[model samples]
Target: MIVETSPENFQVWVHSSRALSLEEKRMWLERMRSDPAAHPKNRWGRCPGFRNTKEKHRSPTGRFPLARLIWIDWDSQADIPLLVPESKPSLLSHPSRRGSVCHPADPCRYHFKKDNESTTDFAYALSLARRGFSDDQIRQRILSERTDWSNHKGEKESKTTSIAPSVVSNR
Candidate 1:
């Protein structure tokens, strides 16, 4: 049921969506241009090459021509256009293997496996927040989690607390 399309074909896909109207498609494109969360800071780490601009031209491949128009309309302030390829032969048979198991309705699954590490970070942060952790605490936790603590021998040696504190402290 998942029909894949390139940036060139994005408009076609959007128009073909049974759930979305032409106005809705326009609105979604507008939101995507202004929203940093939608566009993201990292290109390759998130949805890559999606440009928000106002250029009313095609990429010679007919991909996302409307996106180019949007970019031009916005005065070219949005993210670059993403070049998503058509469904691969291998994936044609298994449509569900593209990303995580979470529903598209969930913010955590919005971009899916596009950025697995970032998604993990977001999920961890969300879990910590739900558990009553403050933003700073959650950030610290994620940063700590991402750090390679096992490789930092000096840090480990310094922080290790023992029942006989004096013995370990002296080392």
Candidate 2:
């Protein structure tokens, strides 16, 4: 599915019966020339009909662009490509294993030290903010992903608001 999330910005999604593994998803995203900062876990796209309020998208008519569904190829039956096995490296050949805290049992070994739940949530919220999501929408998404935030009343709202300026400045 291809959605026009702004005047010219688009997001594409591939629906498949078989779920792609993390590596496979990353490979597919790369193949598709997606945003480099986009993570495989951030699967949701901008909601259609919502106004894209980025100043750059604002028209001379004093209105923002609305996100809309551009196209959908429902009949396409494409599948993710299969990856060939590469020669394995010995455990000793791994660089991080030398002194890092990551262990075989640590599921987060694939991520960097800066990629904790809070940081991930913030990044997700920031992405939404950049895409012109309303504060309520961003807050709802952050709270849904990080249920622990519900205990901290208003934190999600504050964070979502904070990201709006950052998103503007970033451009």
Candidate 3:
């Protein structure tokens, strides 16, 4: 479903974007204001007709909206709302799909502990969470994934049974 519309709107956007330069944006804004459909929006991504390209907003290039053009200020170094826009790549990038079937939930620890892991490792978990899966549901989803754990070892050398511990400890 590759849809190509007027590049005119995109051109105006490219010109006025803060991601480029104030002088350039000003030049474009002034030049395009006269056009009837020159509204600061375009058909891109799952959304369309956005005035800005913030993660919450859409741009002429869809998810690849120019990083600088998003509504946030570059000086502030704000984070764009996380939106991968598509489910296929999202699902395909899962750790399980990549042959690592497990999302290790230690004896008991916060999931963020695995933040340093590959993005693929967190893909499924993140997907579940984003789709409104509860914390327990997300954990269950991870545990349900199949992975070859033959090469790895747990923290304890002793052969102990796996148990789901409450996240909050009494200590």
Candidate 4:
């Protein structure tokens, strides 16, 4: 089973023991290409407010920089696995490690863990649109998703913390 999620909908496509025909593959690709979010131009659109000379040097790939993968057990008999598309020779190969399972309560339970250290390319782009940082500036401040920063004494913390409304009101 293969699952593809986008801003619009989440769909699961199942394959049996037989391999998909060339035409079938083409059809699936066509559907994906037709989606607005999946379109290469939309996926790589310029950030609203930032200017970065280095970002201009990036290759224009059709795939989004921050696209995430989630695994689910199609057979129900097997465990879900983590998938890294870049490391795989092809999409047909199965992942070696099983990823964290989807919790029953959360619909989107697969936590995305990026292999690289820098901020996700797409996320950096979004931050540029929202906060407007230069290429060098973005590069210097961006941290890996796994990075943990803390504050000592009365100094402000580097990380942004989300506070629930109820919790905030009680303070």
Candidate 1: C-alpha lDDT? 0.38
Report the CA-based lDDT of candidate 3 relative to the real structure. 0.35
Best by lDDT: 2
Across residues 51-145, which tens digit of lDDT does each residue of candidate 3 receive?
34345545545753332322323244323223322243344443342233343533222343443323323544444433344556555544444
**Of the candidates shown, which would achieve the greatest TM-score relative to the real structure?**
2
> For residues 27-47, could you state the per-residue lDDT of candidate 4 as single tens digits?
555655644344322234333
* C-alpha positional error of residue 135 in candidate 3 after TM-score superposition, expressed in Å: 1.6
Stretches of candidate 3 exceeding 4 Å from the true structure: 1-118, 151-171
lDDT of each: 0.38, 0.64, 0.35, 0.34
Q: What is the Cα-based TM-score of model 1?
A: 0.20
Model 2: pairs clashing at backbone N, Cα or C within 3 Å: none
The local lDDT score (0 to 100) that residue 71 gets in candidate 4 is 52
Q: Report lDDT (Cα) of residue 138, candidate 4.
A: 34
The digit string of per-residue lDDT tens for model 1 on 1-171 reads 111123443321122313444344445656567333333223222122454332454365654422222221322233433434446444344433223333333233232233445545555544444444455565555555553334443332222211113332233
What TM-score should be assigned to candidate 3?
0.21
Candidate 4 wrong stretches, greater than 4 Å: 1-15, 31-67, 74-171
| Candidate 1 clash figure, as a count | 19
Model 2 poorest ten-residue lDDT run: 104-113
lDDT of 2 by residue, 47-88 (tens): 778888889988999999889988888777566567654556
lDDT of 2: 0.64
